[model samples]
Target: MVEKSKELKEKEQKILSNKTQSIYALALLIGFCIVINIIFSFVNFKIDLTEEKRFTLTPSTVQMLNGLKDNIYVEVLLEGQFPAGFKRLQESTKDLLDQFRSESPYVQYRFFDPLALVTVAEKNNRIKDLAEDGIKPTNLRVMEENESTEKIIYPVAVVKFGSKSIPVNLLENSIAGFSDEEVLNQSINLLEYKIADAINKILRVQKPTIAITKGHGESKPIETQDLINTLSPFYNLKWISLDSMYTVPDDIKLIIMPNPSVKFDEKAKFVLDQFVMKGGDVMFLINRLKIDMDSLRNVRAEYVPIENDVNLEDMFFKYGVRIQPNLILDLECSKIPLVVGKLGTGAQTELFKWYYAPLLSSNSINPIVKNIDRVNAYWTSTVDTIKTKTDIKKTVLLSSSQYSRVQFAPVRINFEILRYDPDPSKFNKPNQPVAVLLEGKFPSLYENRVSPDMLKTLTDIKAEYKSSGDEAKILVVSYGKLINNLYNPTQSDYMPMGYNTFEKQLYGNKDFVINAIEYMFDEKGILAARAKEVKLRLLDTVKIKNERSFWQFINVLLPISLLGLGALFFNILRKRKFAS
Candidate 1:
C-alpha cells in the first residue's frame, strides 16, 4: 500500500509537468501569431464600444450602410492641426464608423494628411461639397509666432463607402472650421434618413404626405413656397384650401392654418373641428393681433387695439392656449438696415428693426429643436398660458428673453423711435411664450353630439360653453409668419417695402414652420426625414493634422501602450501562482 502511494504521487508530478509544458507551448504559439498579425495586418483592428449590441443597426444607418455597392472608404483629411471641437468629433466618428464597419463588412476608413499630401490635398473637392450640404466647421485657430500669425489650413475627411464617396471639408469657409463633433452628431441624428435614402436608391418606397389647409382663408399653396421647399424633399406635398370646392384627402396628415384672414363659416369651422376630432394634428398660425411695424420716418406706425382677432379666441381657449392680442418685443430685435446719409450711399444704418420680426433665442431643448440654433421670427405675437382641463402635457418650445415685453397691435413704436424716455424696465422679463407645443387628450368640439343641420351650417356656430367629455387635441403656437411671408420691415424711401420673393427666402423661419407642422402631425415619422446639418462636414486641414497627431501621439497611443504593457506583465505573474 505504501509503495503504491509513492507511485501515485510520482504520476501526479509528471501530469503537472506536462501541463506546464503545454501552457508554455500555447503561450509561444499565441505570441508568434500576435507578432505575425501585427506585421502583416494592413488595416488596424479598431474596436467600437459605443453600443452594447452588435449586428443591429438603426434604420437610417442601415440604409446608409447598404448604400455601399463597393466598399465605402472614409479619409480623415487634416493638415498641421485641427480645431478644438474636431478632436471630439473625430473620436465620436471613429466610434460610430468602427461600429458601422462591424455591421458593414465592406466599409473602410483612412486618414489623409492634406499637408503631407499637398498634390492630393488641393485637388480634393469633397470638403467644399460638404459645406454645400450644410455641415460647416467650427471656429478657426490662428497660430501666432514672433508677432506674426498665419492661419493653418485643416484638411477635410473623405469617405468612400462602396460606390458612394463622401468628403467632409473642415478647414475652409472660414465661418466654420473643424466641426467634426457637429458633423458627427448631425450624422448620427440623421442616421435613419441617410439609411432611408440609401435604401430607397437600393429599394424604392412611397414618400410620406404633407398637407396645408385651405378654403378657410389659409395661405395658398403658392404662398407657402418657402415651407414647401423645406418639406418637399422629405415628403409628398399636397394642398387643401377648404374653400368648399373639394373634400379633404384621406391621406392628409398635417393641416396647416397660416393666418387665415377670412373667418371660417359654419362648414369651414366644422371641417377644421372634424379634422381635429378625428385625431388629426393641427398647427395654427393665426394672427393674434394684426401688426405692421411703424415706418422708420413716421416715428408713429398704425396702432389698433385688436378687439377680436379673426374669431379664434374661443377656439384657442378650448385648446388651453391664450393667443393674446398683444405683440412680443424682444430687447433683442433683429437688426435692420436703414437708408442713412440721405438714401444713396447705402451706408446701411441698423436699428432695433421690428418687421413684426423678433430675433429670439431657443428656450426648450426638446428633440425638435435640440441642436437647432437661434430662431428669428417676424411680426410674431405673444402666446400666453396653455390651460387644459385634464391630463394634458404642455411644453413651451420657444420663448422671448428676460428683456421682452408686449404692446397691443398695431404698435405705435417705429424705426425712428430710439429708446424709451425712462428706464426700459418693462422690456426685460423672465420668460415670455413665443411658441408652445401642447400634447395629450383634448375635449372634442362635437362631444355633445353634432346636429346634422349644424354640420351643414358651416358658418357662424358659436358653441363657446359646450364641453366634450373626453377627446384629446394638440395646439401649436405661432404668429402669422409661420404660414406666409407677406411683411417686410423696411422702406425704400416711401416705396412701401414688401417681400415679392417668397416665404422660403427667409432663413430658418421656413424650417421652423414645417418642423412644427410635422410635430403636430406626429405620424409616419415625417420629422425624422432629414438631418439638421447632415449633408456634409467641413474641417480645417491645417488645424486638424496638428491636433490629431498631437492628441493621439501624446494622449491616446502613449496611455494605451503603457496600459497594455502593464496588463501583459500582470497576466504573466498571475499565471505563476507563487512567483516572487
Candidate 2:
C-alpha cells in the first residue's frame, strides 16, 4: 500500500508540470504574435511569387507616387455586371491601384457603377453627367441563352490630384483590326501604363511647350486636332510661323514640322538651322515622293510621283539621315476599298491590299517603339542613315518588313498594279528603314555654306552663332499622313489619327506619336515602363470542356472517401489504446 501511494503522487506531480509548461508555451506564442502585429502595422512587406511579378510596382511608378504631395482620388467607373473579360480588367485595375496605394498613402480609389439607374430619364441624366466629366461608355455584346444582348458599360477611371483630373480609358478601343476579346486583353496588358501615365500627367509641373510650324503646308488644326487633344494636357502646343518670327520662341523646346508642301526659303531654312544650333529638338514628318491619293478616285486611276519641294535635304544630310526620294511597297500593307465588279448603279467594292500604304513594322528595341503596334504610312518614303565624318547616334525607329521593295521616284502608281500577283523574287530588300531617331550634337547647316552677306539679314538680332550645338534629338519620318485625320461630314467631326474609315479600324499612329514625344521629354523613364510585359497563362479550353464531368466527379467523391477512411482508422486506433 505504501509503494502504490508513492507511485500515484509521482504521477500527479508529473501531470501538473506538463500543464504548466503548456500554458507558458501558449503565452509565449501569443506574445510573439502581438509583437509581429505591431511591427507590421508600422511597416509594409510583400512578396510577389507570380512568374511575371505582376503584383510588384515598377521603380519609376513607385518613385513618381512617392513624390506626391497631395491626396489623389480616383473614381473607377468599371463597376457593375460585366462579362468575364471586363471583370478580369476590373480586377487588374483594382490590383494595380492597390499596388500604388501600398507605395504612396496619398493614393485612394473607389468603384462606381455608371449605369445603375432603372428609369430612362435617370439613365440619360447620368450619362450626360458622365460625359460632362469625360467618362464615356463602351458598348458590349454578350450572349445569354443563345441570344445576343447589347449592354452599355463604362470602362474609364477619372484620376484627380489637386484640382486637375484626367480620364484614363480602360479599354483599348483605338487598336484597329482587333477583335473584342483581343482588345480587352491588350487593355489589361496596358493597365499599369495607362494609370501611371495619368498620374504622371496630373502631378507634372511646368508643362513643356512645342511648336507646330505653320508657314509651310503643315497639317491644319482640324487635321491634327486628335494629336492636340492627346498632348494638350502635358504640353503647351502652338503654331509658330517662321515667316513672321525670325527665330523660334525661347520657351519652345521642340518643333514639329509636318508635311510641308511648299519649299523652305533661305530665311526660313536659316531660322530652322539656327533653332537647331540653339539646342532645340525637332520632329520632321516629310514625304520625298508626292503621290496624290484623291486623284486616283476615278476609273482611269493613275498617280504620278512628283518631287516634293520642301528643301530640308541639306539640313537633314548634315544631321544624320537622308530621306530617299523613293516609296516602299511592302507585302504586309494596309487595305483600301477596291472595285471588284460593277453593279447596275453602284460598284461592288472590296477591301484589297494597297502596297503603297505600307504598315511599317517596328523591330527596334528602342523604348520609344518597343512592342508598339505597326504604324500605317501612306506613300511613305525610305530614309537612309548617312555615313558622315561626324559622330552622331542614329537609331532606326521604324522600317518595312522583309518582303518589301523600293519604287524609285516617277514610278507610275495605278490601279492596275493591284491585279498583279507580286513575285517574291522582286521584293529582295529586307528591313528598309523609313523612320529614324537622330541624337547628338549637330553641325549647323549654314556653318560654311552661308556667306558673310547672308549674315547681314540677321543684323537686327545680335546673337553669337555656334557652329555646332549641344545635345539634341530629332525624329524623322519619311511619311506625314500618319498625323493626318480624315473628316466625316455626317458626324461633322474629324476622325482620330491612324483611323481608317473604310476598314473601320484604328491603327497605332496616335500611340507612336504620343510615345515619341513622351520619350523625348521623359527624364524619369516613364515611357520605358510601357515596355513591361506580363506573360499570360491560359488553360486549354478544349481539354477543360472534354474532361469537365470526370473532374467534377473526382472532386466531389475523393474528399469524402478520404474523410471516411481517416475516421475509421482513428476509431480503430483509439479502441486499441483503451483496450490495451
Candidate 3:
C-alpha cells in the first residue's frame, strides 16, 4: 500500500509541472503576436483613407518620375552648424523629401559628411559626364563653422536614370542665388517643388528658365540673389548681362527689369524685342524718378524726375500707363516717420506723412494676388488703362487706396516738415491713381522702331504681356521698389504704417512676388498662404473684478469629487467580495 501511494504522488507532481509549462508557452505566443502586429502597423501605415484613389501631382514632378527609366540617388552632404534659423529650414526640407519618398519609394536617399569623406568631396567637385544620355550635375553649399576651419556643405546630389546622371546642390537654404527673408520664405513654400525639379532634371525634362537683364544700376544679379534664390527652385534662372551677352536664351520665360537707372542700348533692345515677339512674358518695373540720399535732406524728401531719350510712349500708350517725368505721391497712402525735428516733445510722436502706398488687399478674385496681403511701397505711380485693339486680356494687380493723390515731377515736399497742422495748398486731391493693371494683346517693340530691342522697347508701360495677342498676358506694377527690396523696417524705426527693413516681415511682399511669377508662368499654386486676422477687444477692469471666480472654481472641482466618490464605492465593494 505504501509503494502504490508514493508512485501516485509522483505522477500527480509531473502532471502539475506539465500544466504550468503549457500555460506559460501559450501566454508567450499571444504576447509575441501582439508585439509583432504593433511593429508591422508602423511599417505600412496609411494616413490617407483613400489610398487607392488617384492624387493630383504637380505637372513638372509628375513628368520627371514618369520619364525616369532607372533609379536616382539623393545624397545629403551636411555635417555642421548652420546660420541662425537654419535648423527649421533643414527640417522643412527633410519633411519635403519624406513626402517625395512616400510617392516614389524607389528614389534612393543617402547622406554623407563631405567634410569627413574625401572621396565624396572629389566626386561632387569633379565635372563628370552626366548628359551623354542627357543629365546635369548640381552643386550645393552648406555653411558651418568649426574652431579653426569654417566648414560648408558643398555636396553634389547625383540623379541617375538609365545611363544619364544629374547632380543638384543643396544649401541650408537658397534656390540658385542667396536670399534674405524673401528667398528663405519662398524656399519654404516650394520645398516640394525643389525635390520635383531635382528629380525631373535627373530624368531629363524641359524646365522653364528666367532671364534677368544686367547692366546700368540694376541691382547686381547677385544682390537680387534673394530674388534668384526664390525663383530658381521652380524655374531655371539665367543671368544675361546684356553688356556681355546681347542675346536672351530661347527657354527664357519671364524677364524682370527692376529699377534700371541706365538706358538700354540698341543691341540690348534688339534682343529684348525679338524675345518678346516670341511670346515671352515681361515684368516691367522702372522708376520714374532718380532717388538719391541728398534728395531726402531738405524739410521734405526731394526727388529728381527721370528723363528717357527713347520714350516707351507708344508701347505704354497701347498698354495704358504713361511714365510721367514725375513721381507719384499720395497723401492718403503715406508712411509716418519720426521726422528729425520737433518743438515741444523733441522728436514728438506724430504721423509724419508718406504717400498713399496702401497695403494691397489679397484679392480672392484674382489668382496673382490671391492670398497676398500687401507690398510695402511709397511714392508709387498711377497706371491708366490704355484702350488697346489687341485681344490680350488685362487685369490690374495693384492700386492705391480710394483717398489718394498724385505729385508731378517738378513738385517739392519734405516729409520732415509736415506738421500736424494742415497745408492744404501744398498737397493734391483726396484720392488719385497710384498704379493700375492693363492686360491685352501687345504688339512687338520692333513693330515700328528702326532696329528697336523688344525687351527695352517699352511698348506697353500701362499694359503687360503685349506679345501674346490672345494667349500672351503681362503684369505691370508702376513702382520699381515693389521688387526693389530697398530695406525692411524695424519695430523701433518703424511707424504704425512704415517700411522697416529688419523688423517688417514679408506679410504680403513675398506673396506679390511669387504670385507675379506664378501668374507669368500660369501656375495657380503660387499664392496660397492667408494673412493673420486677430480681433481682440479688452474688457473693462470692473468686468474682470466681478465675482465669477466662485462659480468657475466649483465647475473645476465637481468632476474630481465625483471620481473620488466612485473610487470609494468601488473599494467598499472589493472589501466585501474578496477581502476574506
Candidate 4:
C-alpha cells in the first residue's frame, strides 16, 4: 500500500512537471511573438520577391508621395464579381494604394462597386451619371454553362484632393494585335503613373502656359478640341499669332504649330527663330506632301499628292532635321471602306487596307515614345536628320515598319491601289522615321542674315537678337494631321485624337502627344514611371487542364493525410513516454 501511494505521488509530480514546462514554453512563445511584432512595427519594410519588383515604387513616386501635405482620397470603382483578370487588376490597385498609404499617412482609398445591389433602372441611371462624370464603362461578356451574359463594369478611379476631383481611367489605351492579357498587364504597369499624375495635377499651384500658333492655317479649335480637352487640366493654353507679335510671350513654355497650309513670311520666320533662340520649345507638326481625302468621295476618282510648300525647309535644315517630300506606304496600315463591286442598286463597300495610312510605331528608348502603342498617321512623310553646325542630339520618335516604301510627291492616289494587295517584295525600305526630336543649342537661322534695321527694331522692343539659342528642344513631325481630332457631325463634338471612325479604334496619338509635352517639361521626372514594366506570367492552360486532378489531390489529400499521420505519431510518443 505504501509503495502504491509513492508511485501515485511520483506520477502526480511528473504530470505537474510536464504542465509547468508546457506553461513556460507557451509564455516564451507569446513573448517572442510580441517582440517580433514590436520590431516590425518600428522598422517598416517589405520584401518583394518578384523578379521585376513590380510592387516596389519608383524613386520619383516615393519622393512625391512622401512630400504630400494634405489627404488624397482615391475611390476605386473596381469591385464585386469579376473575372480573374479584373480581380488581379483590382488586387494590384489595392496593393498600390496600400503602398502609397505606407509612404504617406495622407493617402486614403476605398473600393466601391457602383452597380452593386441596384435595380436595372437604377443601374442604368448610375452608369449614366458616372459617364457624365467622365468615368467610362467597359462591357464584359461572360460565358457560363454555354450561355453568354453581359456585364458592365467601370475600370476607373476618382482622386480627390482638397477642392479638386478628377476621374482617372484605369484602362490603358488598347493597341491593335495585342491580346487582352497583354493589355491588362500594360494597364497594371501604368497604374502608378496614372494615379500619381492625377494627384500631381490637383496639387499644382501654377500651370505652365502653352501657346498654339494661329494665322498659319493651323487646325481650328473644333478640329483639335480633344487635344485641348486633354491638356487644359494640366496647362494654361492660349492662342498666339506669330504674324501679329514680334516675339512669343515670355510666359509661353511651348509653341504648337499644327498643320499650316499657308507659308510663313520672312518676318514671321524670324520671330519664330528668335523665340527658339530664347530657349523656347516648339512642336512642328508639318506636312511635306498634301493629299486631300475629300476628293476621294467619288468611287472612281483619282488624286495626286503634291509637294506642300510651307517654306520652313531651310530653317528646319539648319536646325538639324529635314522633312522629306514624300509619303510612307507600309504593308502594316489602317483599313478604309472601298467600293469593291455593285450589289443590285447599292454599291458594295468593303474595308480595304490603305497603305497611305501607315500605322507608325517606335522601338526607340526615348521616354516620350517608350512603350506607347502604334500612332495612327495619314500621309505621313519621312524625316532625315542632317548634320548641323552645333552638336544636336536627335531621336526618332515614330517610324514605319519593315515592309514600307516612300512615294515621292506627284504620286498618284486612287481606288485602284485598293483593288489589289501590295507587293511586299517591292516595299524593301524599312524603319523610315516620320517624327524626330532634336535637342541642342541651336544657332539662329537669322544669325548673320538679320538686317541692321531688323536688329534695331528688336532692340527697340527690348527683345535682343540671340545669335545662338540657349539649350532648347524641338519636335519635328512630318505628319501635320497627327494632332487633328475627328469631328463627328452627329454629336457636333469632336472625337478623340487617334480615333479611327471606320475601324472604331483608338490609337496612341493622344498619349504620345501628352507624353512628349510632359517629357519636355518634366523637371520632376514623373513621366519616367511610364517606363516601368510588369512582366506577365500567365499559366499554361493546357498544363492546368491536364494536371488539374493531380494538383487537387496533392493540395487537399496530401495535407490532411500528413496532418493525421503527425497526430498519430504524437499520440504514440505520449503513450511511450507516460505508459510506465
The candidate that wins on TM-score is 2
Q: TM-score: which is higher, 1 or 3?
A: 1
lDDT of 1 by residue, 107-210 (tens): 67665554354454553464465566533443355545545444434444554434544445432121122264554555445433333333333222455676
How many clashes in each candidate? 67, 1, 50, 0
What lDDT, from 0 to 1, does candidate 4 have? Answer: 0.89
lDDT for each candidate structure: 0.55, 0.83, 0.53, 0.89
For model 3, how does the per-residue alpha-carbon lDDT over 1-580 read when each residue is reduced to its tens digit? 9999998899799889989999999999999999999997567444544332112344455444544555666765434456554554566556555655655667777655544545765744542433332233323344435434434443334555565544554322232233454444544544454455456444435557877666766665434545654566457876576655445566787787766777776556655655565667777776566653345654244444444333345566655556655555444443544545677867644445455345444233565654244556754565666556555555666655444456666655554335565465555453334344445456665554443343344454322233333345555665565654432244322122223433334445655776567667644332222111112223566765785686576788888889999999999999996665
Give lDDT: candidate 4, residue 298. 46
Q: Can you rank all candidates by TM-score, best first? A: 2, 4, 1, 3
Superposed by TM-score, candidate 4 places the C-alpha of residue 95 at a distance from the truth, in angstroms, of 0.6
Q: List the residue pairs that clash in candidate 4.
A: none
lDDT per residue (tens digit) for residues 1-580 in model 2: 9999999899799889989999999999999999999999888898889886777777888888888888999999899777888899999999889889988899999998867766889899988988887678888898888999998888999999878999999887645455666667677767887888888888877888999989678878778888887788789998988877677778898899888888888788888888888888899998897665776675275777788979889888889889988888899888898779989999998988888888887877687785467888888888999975467899998899999999887787788887878887898988899899998888888887776766665665765566788878899998876677887657768888888888787778888898888877876767766776676566889999999998887999888999999999999999997696
Higher-scoring candidate on lDDT, 1 or 3: 1
Candidate 3 residues lying further than 4 Å off, grouped into runs, are 1-209, 214-217, 220-225, 228-251, 262-271, 298-310, 319-353, 356-358, 364-368, 421-441, 445-473, 485-499, 502-511, 518-580
**Top candidate, metric lDDT:** 4
